[model samples]
Target: MALGWWGRQPVAVLATAVVVSAAPILSPAAGDRLIGDTLPVEAADALDVITPVPSSLGADPDRVALGRMLFSDTRLSRRGDRACISCHDIRSNGASAVARNLTTDGTPVPRNTPTAFNAALSFRLGWAGDIPTLHDQAELALTRPEFLGGSWPRILDTVHGDPVLAALFQAAYGHAADREAVIDAINSFERSLLTPDSRFDRWLRGDVHAITQAERAGYALFRGIGCAACHQGANVGGNLFEKVGIFVTIPNRSAEVLRVPSLRNVAVTAPYFDDGGVATLPEAVRLMARAQLGRELTASQTASIVAFLGTLTGSFEGRPLTASRASGTAQPGDTP
Candidate 1:
């Protein structure tokens, strides 16, 4: 069976029959081929690609300072209402739990806001892998219709108009405010958001006492039941793309394919998956096991894995209350 993030399975033969009858002939046939294979050797190779977390690209003192300022700057938005940190909140786990954050006009966005914590480690950015790097993603977040809904030229104009911001831009990049420097500073700040001191990291570094016995058992079960087929490595996931349902049928939304998310700090970033359909962590665990593993897990097993996941949470390193140019009392979405 194809493994999922958690080890639950579709009901039983009855569930299998229902899936087979409803599924297109090709899907079940493909699933059977996948199941017959003995844990694709590529799975191990996938794990090998994961490397220890790296320092942020623009983590120098000046760049980080500029990026932090830009991150919370509300003027980057069209309505002067949303900042990058609005959705990618520094205090939270880099995301809000809501299905989507409201736009300046209160139009609900189409997808959940993904956490920015450890985003620099992602092989690809965004749920659909639409953007390529932190720089590109930051640009999209500023200009995407569903996001800040502004243009690059307007962004440059706003940054240059702010005397404090322009000075900071000069300090960070040795030039006055412009789009390139803005993205560089923002990306630099984002790069600094890495969190690697979790209990799992300690365990990897030979501190056996870092994690609990139950967590260790859950980690074992995670591999034993095939959850690691897609969720392996330092990030524990986000390295590869996988169909949502490998052994069973999954409800599809507009975009059918999704990149696996990193398990780091997953405990606080709730309402899981690309759609944010599943509300609780346990339900997500159960659903994943059923949909991917083609095997059922005991409640105890699910609880243990959840316990291990809790250990993934770590501290947010960015400063929350930094000065910005011409900022009054800032609301949730306001740009700097």
Candidate 2:
């Protein structure tokens, strides 16, 4: 049982939400032998940094239910044609398969659309660490001219105006559509978007058969080459804000320091990096190895690491998430 931001602590102190891992599975022959029998005591201690995903969210069912519909409802958008789903697609790892997210105001969003899945578990929100919580992010995104281009009053009118939405919001919040209530419902629903039970998560939970030997080797390589220094938690890399070009120079430098993204579902969310410039995972991995770790990996090492990353792709609403575009390094044919 992995614990995310919801299970660890209440959202009142969500900024400091740190995860506590579940008890490790005590198996030898089933999952990756990275622990219990195979890994030494010191090596196992290193794994303490990584945790498993929680099974469920700590939110009101009614509010979460309402939030789910609101998340995809274009009616909530300013133009009534570009809702949250226009940028954050649930079917595609909680993000649109594009570099820059589009807005209804005919202007491109300034930053890449980070995955909303398991986002509550992050220490800080947004690429620049500007937003504090999911609720704040929601409120800001709703009104940004380059985003939904919506105002709370206008959104409240839309929600209260529509008979269906009004009923849902009233049922969930015991009140008509309002800013606080709407944001709360959306926040609650976003908390429910955790993608747990990945193969790596299963392995962490003590199932040796969950991941393959190659993936285990890749995990070893991921840490062995120091990739896990920043990417070392339940969400993997969202905990820290580190400089992008620490080791080597990358093409077209943007910001010096950036909020690290979770590597939990990195395989499927391609055209990687803050700017979404890197198109393929292998290319991104190779670039990261050079830029972040000062290590040059061979093709086999990159492939193995990518294989391990594929294990990070988890399911949503009981359906497993598959590779979106075929242009990435780890595709459907790649073993998990």
Candidate 3:
């Protein structure tokens, strides 16, 4: 019997059933052959595991606009120095380039900052999957001294003090600024940050030419080797909590159980894993295969998987997301 990624969760058994049952069967024999490295999967089968990102998650336009302004508003921070965009740069990959972000005193934070793009799609908030909602996450960030560090009274006063923000809040919420309304507006903007229409999504939607042969094969390997057990669904990995190093021991400083990250814009959001120790996409693929699946993949196999992951990069504002030129490519022999 195949145990799930999390020993107690039985995710593999249940998720595999969901995947198999959701797809329409054109030919039972054909589906068998598609699991290997040659043929493309039937579109019907692909939709069962990974669905396309919707253009919108139905956020109110006024809330989104107000939230967009607040996302960059430094007054949200106690020092009036940092903003949400300081770390989650919407202009780039929606994450910090460094392995971790610095606190007010310039000491590094414990974990790598995950991208803000498509974050609302995750079943839970934060790396540990502890926070229940986007509102809670925002509240934590606002109050945590090492993070935004603003007190509730001070934050409310700061917001009400600014004429522009006060007017925007009045227009959006029909009242003066409050903690809940501020967090709610920020959540609305974050929900609007979904990156959709990736090449892989197009392929899943029946555009055969959207992805290359190698990518299709890599996707086959991805599922065949059990990456999909934890990384399936519309956001491609955020729907479940799984422990790292299920097969091999990978070091982690935080809780062993982590919310699987979304692969929506993963190619561009480099410096991967919770620690951000892995530098390249290829390296991350190789490491995860050994750590999670107990498989030591060859260099070519890693490349194919990397190519497939590249297709997961999605568009924001009709423009394709990109990363730094020297983010580093996968080198052979790098393992967990």
Candidate 4:
């Protein structure tokens, strides 16, 4: 295969940076334990590549509770028919399982809804990586015509009218529900959505029995093939941006450069890719390998990688995340 742009960059440079940057955040005592004589050489090597997600982001509890209620309230939408939960169903998959979701006016959303779990750990918000913070993301969703289509004034008016919501806002923010307060509450809840303690995380912390031999082999393959170059760090991929098809090409990709998505709970949040066109995890893995690494993985290699990915599924609020049955009602016209 010809060397693409990805070939020009040294994988070790980014990989080393990711590991070094994690030192201050990741527990040093735990790091010593992971690299100590207790673990196998492979497990210790894996620790230098990807650190475990932190257990908490330390968001405000009152704000988190307020955001939780506001998340489900339909009044936030222009037509009072949708909430943030409409596309991002936190109860099911943190995202819509379909490729895309329809807007309130029936227009299909341009990109797939990425999972809400562990998004706080990512560097930027959205697949484009244009939005800086969860607060901005929430604000965009609230006002964007393609999303909730509601203006701030109207949203605040509704909030002011509702005694229940107003009181909750007062308790959370110590003031009335203004634009900043509303967005801040939602952002607080989003920061609280971290999914920690996956099997892979346990393995990272030196629990040799957390994953099977086959899964460990899969992790080796995942790293050996250079997937870890971009998909490394606490979120396992969200720390940076990269083009999807560095070597080959992915058909129907809407964007070239994208924010590398977090692999946390990835097994549950499918169909894959920004378009959500890929239906299965194995297919997505194969497509990514060929496109990004310029390698056609054998069946066993694909299965092993898939198995390793399954170990990434973590608990949200003390319960395991499952694939959403009500993935999306929208068809594949322009939505998934």
Clashes of 2: 10
Backbone clashes, each candidate: 13, 10, 0, 1
Worst 10 residues of 4 by lDDT: 1-10
**lDDT (tens digit, per residue) of candidate 2 on 82-147:** 667566666666765778865565655677778778888887788886676677888877787777
What pairs collide in candidate 4? 100-336
TM-score of 4: 0.85
lDDT of 3 by residue, 100-208 (tens): 8777566787888888888877777677778777878888878887677888998899889989889989998889988889998988888888788999999888898
Off by over 4 Å in 3: 1-13, 17-48, 251-255, 324-336
Evaluate residue 167 in candidate 1 and report its C-alpha lDDT on the 0 to 100 scale: 86
**How accurate locally, in lDDT, is each candidate?**
0.65, 0.71, 0.74, 0.76
**Residue-by-residue lDDT tens digits, candidate 1, 26-123:** 23233332221232222322222223444344478788888888788777788877788777766656776576677667787777877877777666
Window of ten residues with lowest summed lDDT in model 1: 1-10
1-336: candidate 4 lDDT, tens digit per residue: 001112234355476655543332434344343221223335435445777878777788988888887777778788888887777777766787677888778878888888878888777778888887777788888999888889988899999999999999988778899999998888888888877889999988989899997887777667666677678767777777888788887885543898888787889988888888899999999999999878898888799889999999888888878887664632211211
**Which regions of candidate 2 fall more than 4 Å away from where they truly are?**
1-48, 324-336
Total colliding residue pairs, candidate 1: 13
TM-score of each: 0.78, 0.83, 0.85, 0.85
- Say which prediction, candidate 1 or candidate 4, comes out ahead on lDDT: 4
Q: What is the lDDT of residue 181 in candidate 4?
A: 93
**Residue 163: error of model 2 in Å?**
2.3
Candidate that beats the other on TM-score, 2 or 4, i.e. the better one:
4
Listed per candidate, the RMSD to the true structure in angstroms reads 10.2, 7.4, 7.4, 8.2
Which regions of candidate 4 are displaced past 4 Å?
Answer: 1-47, 253-255, 327-336
